[model samples]
Target chain A: MPFFKITLIRSSIGLPKKTQGVLNALGLRKRMATVFKPVNPSTAGQIMKIKELVAVSEVEAAMTSAEMKALRKPDPGYYIETPGLG
Target chain B: MFGPFRATSPLSGGLLWKIPWRLSSPQKRRQRKRLRLVDNVVATVDAALKRQNMESGRNLVRWKEEMPTEEEMRPKDKYTMFDRKEKKYRKGIHKLPKWTRVSQRINPPGF
Candidate 1:
């Protein structure tokens, strides 16, 4: 399924409770936070409610949590060629 | 001659909150920019849906087709909103609560 990659580019502080609730429902907890949601009627409606506070784009597939964590994981200075157990 | 300026609230009979009657030039510029961004997002979604042949994103297609282009918008609509009070039935954007956080693009027809 195509996913809508939403990023909370702007803060929701002091906005209406409804708007804030939409952001919360979208899983955008803070500024610069990003969440991928399947593109559908409900998600589109949510995006419309908080369009001013977010940036949205479409992607082919949602990234898994492991893949996202790997992207953020740093490369250590050294890598072991042989395992201790092996 | 003007005395030394002291920016202080009055002892009594002053409003605790004040909203500007008009949007400043910079504020107007930013507002226009935001509207443009929203338009861009809609267009992007429409294109993405078309590419994937997704029929569920109907709003994106209908919205893009109905909303006026930035160039086609009236100057009044571009910069201000409809208000029952004030001259011309329009007022400064800042007067609206959470003006920056909400979309105020659409106004009453013939307003």
Candidate 2:
């Protein structure tokens, strides 16, 4: 199933209470917070309500929290060539 | 000056004095070689097994999909409560004139 990747890009400080509630329901509390939800009419309507404060993208699958953290980590450049004598 | 002087003179003569104190020439120290395990076959096999394990481990991680373009996700237009011409800004959206009116939307044109 396809998923919607919703990211809060702008602050909802001065927006209406209804808009803020939509953001809270979408699991977006602070700026740059991202959440994944299945593509459906309800989610689409919610995104339309606060379209000005978020960026939305359609993705194939959702990544777990651990996977996201591992993706962000940098790779170690060198590998062990020879084992030392124990 | 006759007997004792002649006997000691031969002891310090040219042939005997020309010889060196030591006989053999000094030998150079040899460089030490690094230690290597005797089992060459086992080491090469172990290295090959480790490389295969690493290649299989890389396949376990799934690839992520690409994100949408910026133009697709961008807001329609930039709207702010601050009016540059009047030098006044509204504290909240509820304070705006069109907050309660359904006919007049808060968003500007082309939004």
Worst 10-residue lDDT window for candidate 1 chain A reads A40-49
Cα error, candidate 2, residue B55 (Å): 45
Question: Which digits, one per residue and each the tens of the lDDT, describe model 2 over residues B1-111?
Answer: 566656563566655444332222221010000001111212222233344342211211111022112232222111123333433432222334433221111333333
Model 1 stretches with alpha carbons more than 4 Å out: A64-86, B1-12, B16-20, B56-62
Model 2, position B5, has a per-residue lDDT of 58
Best by TM-score: 1
Best by lDDT: 1
Candidate 2 chain A weakest ten by summed lDDT: A40-49
* Per-residue lDDT of model 1, residues B1-111, tens digit only: 234554545423577556567788999888788878887776666666566666644555556666775666777777788888777788777777877766666688777
lDDT of 1 at B84: 88
> All candidates' TM-scores?
0.75, 0.43
- In model 2, what lDDT does residue B32 have? 7
**Model 1 per-residue lDDT tens digits across residues A1-86:** 88999989989998878888998899999998889998776687678667778899998889876888899999998977876785
DockQ of 1: 0.36
